[model samples]
Target: MVFIRWFLGKCILLINALTLPKPMLRIKADQDKVDKKTQFFTLYQFEACPFCVKVRRFIRKNSLKIDLKDAKNNMANKSELVNNGGKHKVPCLKIEKLNEKTMWLYESDAIIAFLAKETELS
Candidate 1:
């Protein structure tokens, strides 16, 4: 059963790699705006997680420059997720505003939606 699960996981990863999406076109001015807006955002994720993959693909496709934190292997990142985000969940976005306000956003779909909205304004 373990072997079967591992094999299926590998297959899923293979498919995800083979069908990777293309990044969106980045205009210099728009990219600059995106950079300023997302400078305080960081993403916490596990490499092999499907939801993390989805968020990563969205980030790549939109050319967002958000930093990625690996919670699977990094003990500090794991603790940060638990302590700051209030949960140890992949695909959680840490957004810090200019006023020092912070937000912990979870769920892949919502993260993608938030990025889309922010980028559209850029």
Candidate 2:
């Protein structure tokens, strides 16, 4: 009975860890490069969402310039980004570009790769 209880307890702990939201690193911009080529990769994500965390990690670690849109609690941004994206999904990216629109790009990995190429610091 003791062993069974211990095993069950461990399993429960594992499940909790797996279900918990992943943490993300939020960084502040240091320069005034806002009005350049693109208006930074506008990202809509939550601090605990894993997929969102990954994208943020890439941006933070590389110190890439980006406009973060927190959609978990910010209902206005949530509706705009998610509804605009047509899936109400977190971690949605908004690439502001002239000759193109938001449909110009979508997807986390793709956005990450684009930043990596541009920054060349990744």
The candidate that achieves the highest lDDT relative to the unseen native structure = 1
**TM-score, one value per model:** 0.90, 0.61
Clashes of each: 0, 0
What C-alpha lDDT do the candidate models reach, one value each? 0.89, 0.64
Deviation in Å, model 2, residue 105 alpha carbon: 4.4
Off by over 4 Å in 2: 1-38, 104-106
lDDT of 2: 0.64
Identify the runs in model 1 with alpha carbons over 4 angstroms from their true place. Answer: 1-5
Q: To one decimal, what is the Cα RMSD in angstroms of model 1 from the true structure?
A: 1.7
Provide the lowest-lDDT 10-residue window in model 1.
Answer: 4-13
Spell out the clash pairs found in candidate 1.
none
Best prediction by TM-score:
1
RMSD of each: 1.7, 8.6
